[model samples]
Target: MRVRLKICGAVLAASVLVGSALHASSKPRENVTNASDRDYPAAKLSTLRGKIAYSPGVHAHSLWVMSFDGSHRRQITHAGAHADFDPDWSPDGKNIVFRTERGRYDSNNTGAQGIFVVNTKTLRERQIQPRTGGLFPAWAPNGKRIAFTGLNPTCCGEVIVTSKPDGSDKRIVKLPTAAGECLAWSPDSTKLAFCGHQGDGNWAVWVMNADGSNPHQLTHPRAIEPAGTGGDSPSAWSPDGKQIIYWSWQPAGGELFVVNSDGSDAHQLTHWDGGDEATNWL
Candidate 1:
């Protein structure tokens, strides 16, 4: 079947820390009542199954997992400390990998940030990469290795490294000149998709062999820089390995979009005027 490319124009930008207080009051009284409410519009494809996990609201950094159909919603963690933002599910969907701060307001403290794993069924928690600063954790397609962004205080963003499930065999894969973030491993596990800045000061989507060879740029010349409002960016690879879904901000708010793996046929998927970011896929 030919993959249909869909790009949602609603762009959900990353939430930034406004103050020192890591934990804020929960939803307002009026908004609190709406917490249990859910509305899952039918998606074109039913094959996508897993729930979308993300940190919601302005002050609520807690992690949440909800079904694509808008049923079976649950909050996995209540860690009232620094907001837990990035959550990645294991290939088997049995465990969730994420990054969290050690204290309530220590975003700059690299020592406080590390990778952790949670058993979805048992609700048990354990630190996987203890004492090491990392973010944007992505599981390998085989569910054995995990790729994450390692931070080097002396430098900016560190190299992308894959480690064993237990935090062993940590090795860095050489990327382009810029630092890497928001990593997505291809379905076949042969290539990796990430966003990084080029020497020219523009952020663009880049692909590289899993073994760290033949790194190449995927976006066009005009969209290469950070100034352009819209263009290709980092995103997750689809299950079929034919397309990538990412967020782009144009005249409208930032929204989810899909494009061919080779960087062709870009299109929008969501049309929310307020914007919606693509957090994960089933």
Candidate 2:
């Protein structure tokens, strides 16, 4: 059996309440289209700055947004058992694109997970249909496209998929790796950063062109004895697009690291013996 582990970034001093509804859809794959003519209305930058959105739960994960100082906390999605996570803020900061598990957690179950968008202000939610299913949905900084990782039926591995906010004109990027997840786009929207399951029997941080060209590994983390599995999962990029932040798993614990865009000059940012990761950058 293949077990999947989900680790959310660190947030401090916040209270959460559950019980809200977001539109849930189990739509067929045929709903995904090949046309690119749909036009999304342009959005303006939100005046509300320095706000953070995250999903945390002990029973089941739901969405939450709070101010940068950990105040004005509120729960956005209250799917009792459905795990809602991997939120990426829209360029306008008005909506958040996220992934929701339909019923149960099955990594290989096609259509088991669906991509969704939630209005941060009004709490309105809608599903974004992918060809198969969507995970780790990232809204482009330009607000023109959204990207995710999905299971490839024929190849039996994860493949990168990009589509409009409405889930039209789907395009797939087949990476030279066993599996991939936690996709993040650069500030300029020219490149993508994600966690890839390497052929060398380990996971590493990888960067590639937005169109899935010129794929390359960034960090090569070694496995320690007690932990065994070691890898790096990218979280987000800096505002200026010069650096990338990610989490490196180890026997001691997960530590945050900052690296140059070209995979040079990596340095540790945290020494805490806990799982420290950066999910979003403002």
RMSD of each: 10.0, 11.9
TM-score per candidate: 0.71, 0.78
Candidate 2 global CA lDDT score: 0.64
Write down the TM-score for model 2.
0.78
Instruction: Count clashing residue pairs in model 1.
Output: 16
Candidate 2 lDDT, 50-162, residue by residue in tens: 56666654554677776654568688887776677657778888898877775444654543477889998799988775336667788888889999887876877778888
Best by lDDT: 2
> Mind giving the per-residue lDDT tens digits that candidate 1 earns over 50-91?
455655534555666666444676887776845565677776
Q: After superposition, how far is residue 61 of candidate 1 from its true place, in Å?
A: 2.7
